[model samples]
Target: MTTVAEAASWARDLEALAIRISPRFCRLEARERARRYLAGLLAPLERKNGWQLAEAAGDASPDSVQDFLARMRWDADAVRDDLRAYVVEHLGDPDAVLVLDEIGFLKKGERSVGVQRQYSGTAGRIENCQIGVFLSYAGRHGYALIDRTLYLPQPWAGDEERRRTAWVPETVAFATKPKLGLTMLERALDAGVPCGWVAGDSVYGTDSAIRRTLERRRVGYVLTVTSGQRLWPGTVSDWVEEVPADGWHRLSAGDGAKGPRLYDWARLPFRGAPEGWSKALLIRRRLGDGELTFYLTCAPEGTALADLVWVAGARWTIESAFEMAKGEVGLDQYEVRSWTGWHRHITLAVLAFAFLTVLRKAAIKGRGPSRLGGRLDPADRARDSTPASPPPASADSRHLRRYRLVILAKTSSAESKAIALEAPYQNR
Candidate 1:
C-alpha cells in the first residue's frame, strides 16, 4: 500500500533531480517551468499535451508551456547527458545491459518533424508517424530510457523546404535507426554508464557497424539476427540443423509477469575472436510449436549460455520502459511539431519516468527486484501472441497488427455512428 512517508520521499527525490538539472535552464522562470512541466507529466491527466499541462500548472493558457518547449534556449542534449549520469548513479550495475530500440509516435499531418509513412514497430504496419531511436539502461535495480534521437527519413533530410518549415537544423541529416542507436550507445559508454552487454533487435543487430563497434570496444552483446544471417559462411538456420539432440538445453530466458519464460536454447561457436573473447550463434525454440528465433552473441571466453540467454531476455526491458513512459509519463502525448519541440518534450518525459524508476527501486529495496513493481508485464501488451516467423519484421508484427486493428476499429465505429445520424437528417 502507498504510505505518506513513501510519497513524501518520492517528492523529495523529484526536487533533488530538479535542482540537479536546473543548471541547464539559464533563467529562473525557465527552471520553474521545467519543474512544473515535469510534475505535470507525472500528473494523472487524460492527455498530457501542452494545453492540459499548462492548465495543470495553473497557467491561463498553453503559451508559456509551448514556449518553454519550442523557444527555450536550453540544450536538450546537455540535459540528456545529465539524465544518463543520474540513471548510472541510481541504478548502475556492472552486469547491466544497455538496450536499444525505437518507439513510434503516431501523428496525423505532415507538419510534425520526422513524420512519414514508415514501418512503425508500434502500429505493426506502415503509418504516418515519427520514430525515435532510444537507448535504455536496464540494471538489476531498475530500468529507464537514457537517450533518444528522432529518426529523420531520407526524403525529409533532402527536402530543404520542409526542413526549414519544421525548424530542423541544417546540421541534422538522415540516419538509419541502427546508426542512431549506435550513437546513443557510444554516448552512454563515453559517459561511463556501467554496462557489460548490449541487447537489441534485428534492426540493430543486422547492422555490421554496430557489431564491429561493440567488438572493437570488447564489450559483449546478445543481439537478435535474422534466420538467414550468415555466421560461418552458411546461413544460421542451416547451421543450426546440424546440432545433435543433446546440443539443445531447455532454459528460462528470464522472469516475466507470469513467471519464468522457458524455451529450448542452443548455441554454435564461431571460429575467430581475439584471445579471451568469443563469438557464437544463440538460438531459441518455442516449446509447443518448436518455432525458432536466432541471436548473435559476442562475449568473453567461457561465458555461460545461461548468461547469454539472460542478456537476450533482458532486451524486453527497453520495451517495458517505452510502455511505462508513454502510459504513465506521457512520452508520446505531445502537440509539438518542430524539431526542438519534439526533443524538449521527450526529454522532460524521460526525466519524469526516471524519477519514478528510482522511487520504485527504493520502495522495493529489500523485497527483491520486482519487475518495475510488476508493471512491466509484457503479457499486458500481448507480446506472447507474436509469431515466431523468420523475416526481419516478424518479431513485432503481432503487436503492431493488434494496435492497428484497435485504432481502425475505433475509427470505424465512430464514423459509422456519425453517418447513421446524418442519414436521417438528409432524408428529412
Candidate 2:
C-alpha cells in the first residue's frame, strides 16, 4: 500500500521531472507555464480544457491559458525530442520493441487543420477528424509514446491557402500514415533508441516501403498483413492453408486484463529470406469461428515462435498507451486548431502520460499506491506483504476473513466464466 506521504512524494518527483526539462524553454515564463500545464494535465479533471487549466492555475480568467498555447515562445519540437530521450533513458532495453499506430481525434469543423470526413478506427466510420501517427517504446521496464507526427491528407497538403491559415510550413509534404510512421521509425533509429523489433497493423505492415525500410536498416518486425498480401510465390492465406496439423502450436501472446491471451499459432517459412534473415507467414486461428489472422514476419534465423508472438502482442501496447493517456491525462481533450498548437498539446499530454506510467511503476515496486482501492487498501495486500509475519488479529477472526475471501474469489471466477460464455471472444 502506498501511504499518503509516498503518493505525495511520487507526485513531487513527476513535477520535478517537468521542472528539470523546463530549461529547454528560452523564457522563464515559458518554463513556468510548462510546469503548471503539466501539473494540470496530470490532475484528475473530467474535462481538461483551456478554462479548466486556467482554473487549476488559480487564474481569474483563461486569457493566459489561450496565449500560452497560441503565442508562447516555446519550442514544442525540442520538448518532443526530450520526451523521446526521457522514455529511452527510463524504459530502454536491448530487446525492447517499437510499436507504431495511429489515433484519431474527432473534430466538429473543417477548419481544425486536417479535419475532414475520413475513416476513423476509433469511430468505426467516416467522421470529421484529425489523425496523428504515434510511435511507442515498450520493454520490461514499461511503455510510453516516444514520438508523434500529425497526418495531413493530400487535400490539405495541396491547399496552400488552407496551409497558410493553419500555419503549416511550406516544407511540409503529404505523407501517408505509413510514411509518417516510417519517418518516426527512422528518427528513433537515428537517435540511437534501443529496440529489437517493430510491430504495427496491416495498414503499415502491407506496405512494401515500410517493410523494406526496416530490412534496409537490419531491423526485424512482426507485422500484420491482409489476406490478399502476397509473398514471392503465394498469398498469405494460401500459405496458411498449406500448414499441416503438426505445424500449429498453442501459445500465449501475453498477459491481458483477463489473462494470458492463448491462441493456436503456425509459422510458415517464406522463399525470399536473405542470408542471416528469416521470413515467415505467421497465422492465428480463432477457436470459435476458425477465423484466421496473418502476420508477415522478418527476423534473424532461429528466432523462437514465442518471441514472434510476443512481438505481435507488444504492438497492442500502443493501444493501451493511447487508452490510458486519453482517459487519464486528457490526451485527445484538446482545443488546439493550428498545426503547431496540435503538436504542442499532444507532446505535453504524452509527457503527462509518461509521468503517470513512472508513478505506476513505483507503486508496483512496493513504494506507491495499489490498485485495490485507488483509496482504501485491500486486505489481501497485508496478507501478501506479511506472509511470514505473525497475525496481529485473533486466530478466529483471521480464519473467518480468509474463508470469506475464498468465497468471494470463487464467485468472481464464476462470474468471469459466465461473462465469457455470454459473449464469444473475438480476435480484436
Candidate 3:
C-alpha cells in the first residue's frame, strides 16, 4: 500500500513524462482529463456530481481539461505513434511479446461508432457493442497498451442507414478483427517498436494471410490454430514423391504429471504446396480427458522450443489484462454514448491499470510486502491473510469512508449522531 505522498509523487512523475513526450500533450484536454480520470481510478470519492476524480494538482478546470484534451488530436495513427514511442522508451526489449487481442465493450444502445448486435466477449452473448483490437507489449516488468483500433462491422460501415445513425466516421471502413490486428502490428513495426515475436489466439492464427504476412516480414509468431486446420508435412522434395496427406498424425511426449506430453509433430515448407504456403509446425497433444488434438504454428525453424511455448502462453496475459481492466478498473462501465467518449474512457482505464501495474511491480521489486509480512508474528500473519475486515468506523480511513459518513447522516437519528461524532476527528 503506497502512501498518499508516494502516490502523488508517482502521478507527478507520470505527468512530467507525459509532458516530455509532447509538450502539446500537456495542453491537450484529453490528456489532462485522462490524467484526472486515472487519478480518480487510483482513489475514487463519491460526490454530489457522482465521482469527482482527484483534482489535478495544478488547477485544471473542466474548460482547461477539455481544451487540453482537444489540443491533443484523437487520430488513431497519431495515438498509435505516440504509444509506440512510449513503449520503445520504457519497455523496449528485442524479445518482447507483442500480443494481439480484441476486447468488446457492451453498449446499451446502437449510437456508438461500430456498435451493433454482435458477439461481445464482454457480455458473452450477442449484444450491441464496440470491439477494440489492441496490441499490447509485455516483458519482464509488465505490459502496457501499445495500439488500439475500433472494429467496424460490415453492416455498420456498409449500410448507409446504420452508418448515419451511429455517426460513423466517413473514413471508417469494415475490417475483420484479424485484419485490424495485422494493421496494428504493421504500424508498430513501421514505427520501429522492438518486438521479436507476435502471439494471438485462433482467430488470428486461422488466417493464412496473417501468418504469411508475418513470415514475409521475417517476423516469428506463435498463434493458435484449430485442430481441424489442414497442412502438408515436409518439403517440396519430400512431397514430390508422395501425395501430401490431408492430415498428419500428432504425438505426445510427456505424461500428465509432466504437463501433458506433446510431440509427434511434422513440419512443412511453404514452397511445396500448390497454394501459397508458410512453414508450419503441427503438434499433437493428448488430454487427460482422453481427447486428442492438433495445433499448427508458423514458428521459425530455429526458434527455441521454450520460446514457442512462452509465446503461446503469452495470450493468457492479455486475457488477464482484459479481466483486470474490466473487473478491477471498470473498463466497460463508461456511461458516455459517443465514440469519442468511449475511446477516451477506455484509454484512461488502460493507463490507470498500467499505473497500478507499475506500482505493484515496484512494490514487489522493493520486497515491500514480503518484508512487511515477515515482521508480523505467525498468528498475526495468518490473521492478516484472511480477507481484510471492513474499515473501522473511523473518520480518517479514506475519502470513501468520509463520504459514507455524509450519506449515513441523512438516514437515521443514530446514524446521524455517529456521522456527527466522526466528522470533526477526520483528517482532511
Tens-digit lDDT track of model 2 for 1-428: 55687767766776667776787787888888888889899887878889899899888888887778878888887888888887776555666789989988999978988888998887889889998999999866578999998999999999999999998978899999999999999999999998878999999998888889888777888999999997756688777668775666665566678766656678888766666777889998764566889999887776667667778878878999999888988899888889988988899999888877766655555544333123224573454334232322432222111110000011111112211211111112
lDDT per residue as tens, model 3, 80-144: 46546655554455656788888887766667677778887767888777888888886544667
Could you give me the TM-score of model 3 versus the true structure?
Answer: 0.67
Between prediction 2 and prediction 3, the one with superior lDDT is 2
lDDT of 2 at 404: 9
Q: TM-scores of the models, in the given order? A: 0.85, 0.84, 0.67
Give the per-residue Cα lDDT of candidate 2 at 119: 89
Mind giving the per-residue lDDT tens digits that candidate 1 earns over 195-279?
A: 7889999999999999989888878899998998877678889886766666776655565665556666788888766566778
lDDT of 3 at 395: 29
Candidate 1 has a TM-score of 0.85
In each prediction, how many residue pairs overlap at the backbone (N, C-alpha, C within less than 3 A)?
2, 0, 8
The models' CA-based lDDT, in order, is: 0.78, 0.76, 0.54
Q: Itemize residue pairs with steric clashes in candidate 1.
A: 123-400, 124-400
Kindly state the number of residue pairs that clash in model 1.
2
